[model samples]
Target: MLMGEFWGLGVRFRVSAMENCWDFLQWLGPDASTCVFASLDDPSDLVRASAVSRSWRRFVIANGFSRSLCRRICPEVSNFTRAVEVSSSAMNQEVGSSTAVEWESLVREHRIYSYLCRCLVSPEGSSDCIDRCIGASSTDNFPDESIENTLEPSDRVYMRPSYWSSGGEADPQVPESLIYRLGSDLCVVNEIKIQPFKAFFQHGDPIYSVKFVRFRMGNSKLPLRSENYVTDENEGQAAADDNFVWTYISPEFPMLQESVLQSFKLPRPVLCIGGVVKIELLGRVQKQAMDGLYYICVSHVQVLGRPLSPKLALDTSEASGASVLKYFPVDSSSVAPNGASRDDEAREPSRWHAFAATLRHLRAGGAWNQAILNTLLRPVQFAEEDDDSDEEEPYA
Candidate 1:
């Protein structure tokens, strides 16, 4: 819902602007169904009304029209029941007649059941869950296909013959696992003998896979998945370890790479399935690895900005190079080189600059999050202990 984006950004709060959007929706009210269905392909994920609110979320869930949306739109496992249940119960309770109540209850039950199916059957973070959930009928969407069941990591490990040479007597370096972009941002890490499952948030956003590098100037290497990858039966340790790696390349900016951070960008207007969760506030903050990179679980979006459409297309020709899987023009100015509009391009600089600037601002605002910047120039801190231990104290 680009209109909603306009609304979300507070652009439409003006009296005239609000009136115009309302009138436009009314004019296209009869055609809204067409628009909503057509929106499945909308480049800007923010434009889809389903991505807009709980009210809209309820509408799609009840109608059962956007079966492809279940995976992406369904709430996170933590919030699924809360977002859907509250809405469904309220909708059912509001039905005035007994027959209508029964029908609504049936619809609610189906929606709940479908959501549960999504939780069990869909791959964690993959939009395929949405497809399965939406397509499931009462007869078909069983508990076996619930979202919980699908989170099984063993099932996630894909086993297939891969030709990359990994380990050796000394350096076990396999040519990198081929990364396949499932969507603009969604991708699956094709690690052979393990599951080939990777999921970026919402539909079609940038997904990143950092192969756990375990080497320095001289050392043996370790793949994240050793044949004997050990953890509890529940795999909590492994799951916890599989956080999004937050890296702080510059040593001086260590604090900038806190365990958590946040910034906002309107993603491409795709149908939103799940409610967003604020996971940054859940635990005690801690330091990560030396490079300020630590695994973090955070929500990221692959928005379909106008520029990314042409810029992010897959070119098999470029597969062998240091390819940009997808690029989000964070600032308006960056778009000018590509020749977009001045207004759109103007926002590009600020947009992208936000990603880098977000950390600094959040720190200033006392928000509990961090940001990463490409290393240009950074200060390195010297250890105080080294200075105190020096034999020649003054200038050693």
Candidate 2:
């Protein structure tokens, strides 16, 4: 009987010890637990960890673990501090909800900061192409060097020229504007880079650049599919007068008169709500050779930002529109269009030929002429030959 009682007591003690071991907080001190959580580089990992137990969630929230990690990764997100404070204040004012609100605010801040951190570390992809150009009053678009070509990554020297006079001169006061549509209505932009185009073929090879550039973010009310799209006809109109409003405006920054790619970073990350970005090549233009007229020319332009998750809310009432823009990846061909057939690239040439032959035979009925059939039977090629020639020499 004595032995049995002793055994039972030992069993109970072991069970209690096991329970104590399971209490992760008590096992790992607060400082050690924080260090462990901070070691997780990915936000997704932290989220999974939070799910393991309630204590972990509380620890994460109280320490602002995700926010600290985000700041460590991208220090530019300092602008988020005031936003967090405002949210906390607003939450505290509600009756019987102070604790709940604090927890909720911490969770929200963790999600946002983690997202920004992910974007900062993610690989730079293709440039988010601009949907249209707005207020480019006097564009000198050559057939070979159209304004659209400014986004291309070819060896060809693509440039957008604005001529104010017949002698290939431009006005210093007038600013050329380009509007780019982002993939998401709400995105975080980080940096923007612009390369000024130099007319090297012409005498004196003047570089067309502005003294400074400015940027704005807002939504456009214009219909996307309308045939009567707005253009330079309303060039002189201010942005407020037009359908687009400037929700956020960047400070005017001076531009260099060289052909190198110059970068301009935002004061902080901007949450652009409307998906539209307006770039204003501001200030007086650089001088021209013979006419002495000023002109602003851009060889290439890139906007970089992290695309927002589809699950995130689109509410912008309390968000700031002061984000960054980054350049797209250099290899544009790798980016597949939405809804495109992925299998087209996977098939071998022989398999494609077989498929084409089968298709031709099925359509060999009456009215299908041999010439037309032959044309249809030919395999379509989508690959573009890579060009390795240097497009432009860097300015001395």
Candidate 3:
């Protein structure tokens, strides 16, 4: 009788174990698959999960798992799906079947958005200097001061003393504008830093400080090859300002009244298709002693972003045609009697006077013309020049 009882107990245990296994399988249905995938953070992991089995791939594609992951990573790309759908539909009418077109479009969006997400989250593998500043603009600049000076990197208190300034006039309502052109047609701007200049030599307090600053990204009506600078004809006029139509406007940020570098990060990554950024100094809190007018000054300005390259290697042959204005400061002590660097006596002019003479030489060859010079000298304006009806292409 004891032996019979042991056999019955063994049978009961086996049945129970089988039932438990069955129950666990039931728990892993479509709903459970979704729940598991939803918990995953990486889009690449989700793609790998889809390849595990036919059922998982179906679940990922049917429920749009990749798309959901993209939305979660970059909420700003919410419209990407609708835009892709429209584009896919238009393409479907051309050749492929509707189902194939839809599938292809979904895959494309997942790939593009996934790449963008990686760019935002991943550590920067390398840092290559992207020369995008085609030109610069300012509202008012002091004589002997150049906006190009702000692009240089320095450790001095006044990195580049040659700064753009609002004229010696106090008007809180009139804001100063500084515009920078991205040499490329489009770039992904990540960060911008501005260092306000302080006149330590002043008596009562440091004058020419910026109190408030804002930013705007927009498209330019002019061709990309054209120099992006204010001309003498449009100086202090609204027409120059009208040339650029702002697409994305940033919120106003308060600036510290010191010479320290201030950084402003975009709320989210922005696709700056317009290839131009305009920095607007809304409040001038200090006045200059010599001029007795309100002035805002900046020692340096920097734009940190990635340039888009379709090809593996960028063709820079055309880049020569693009006018790039850069300044290199010369150490007076290193100069030889004949005005050359110690190492290379055949070096180009390092002094301001010699540099100006070289610019004149370049201008004579029609390489640097009046428009380019005016852009370097005057402030950009904001008025409509002509009634040419050219509309910007919609973002895809």
For each of the candidates, the C-alpha root-mean-square deviation to the true structure, in angstroms, is: 25.3, 16.0, 16.0
Instruction: Write down the lDDT of every candidate, Cα atoms only.
Output: 0.25, 0.52, 0.51
Q: Taking the tens digit of each residue's C-alpha lDDT, what string does model 1 give over 1-396?
A: 464464454323333545554533334464674455445522232224444544444454455433334334422222122212232135347658887776565454434434333323334442221110011111112222222222232222123111111111121222121111111211211111112222222244222122231100000111122211111111111212122121111111111221122222212122211100101111112212323322222112121112122222211123332211222222323433432212111111222222323332343345543333223112222221111221111100
lDDT for model 2, please: 0.52
lDDT of 2 by residue, 279-357 (tens): 7887655676666776677766667676543322232333353332221112223333321212112222323423443
- Name the regions of candidate 1 deviating beyond 4 angstroms: 1-24, 41-62, 65-68, 71-99, 106-396
Query: Candidate 1 — worst ten consecutive residues by lDDT sum?
Result: 130-139
Question: How does model 1 score by TM-score?
Answer: 0.21
Full ranking by TM-score: 3, 2, 1
**Candidate 3: tens digits of C-alpha lDDT, residues 61-90:** 667766576567644334221322122133
The number of the candidate with the highest TM-score is 3
Better of 1 and 3 by TM-score: 3
- Give candidate 3's whole-model lDDT: 0.51
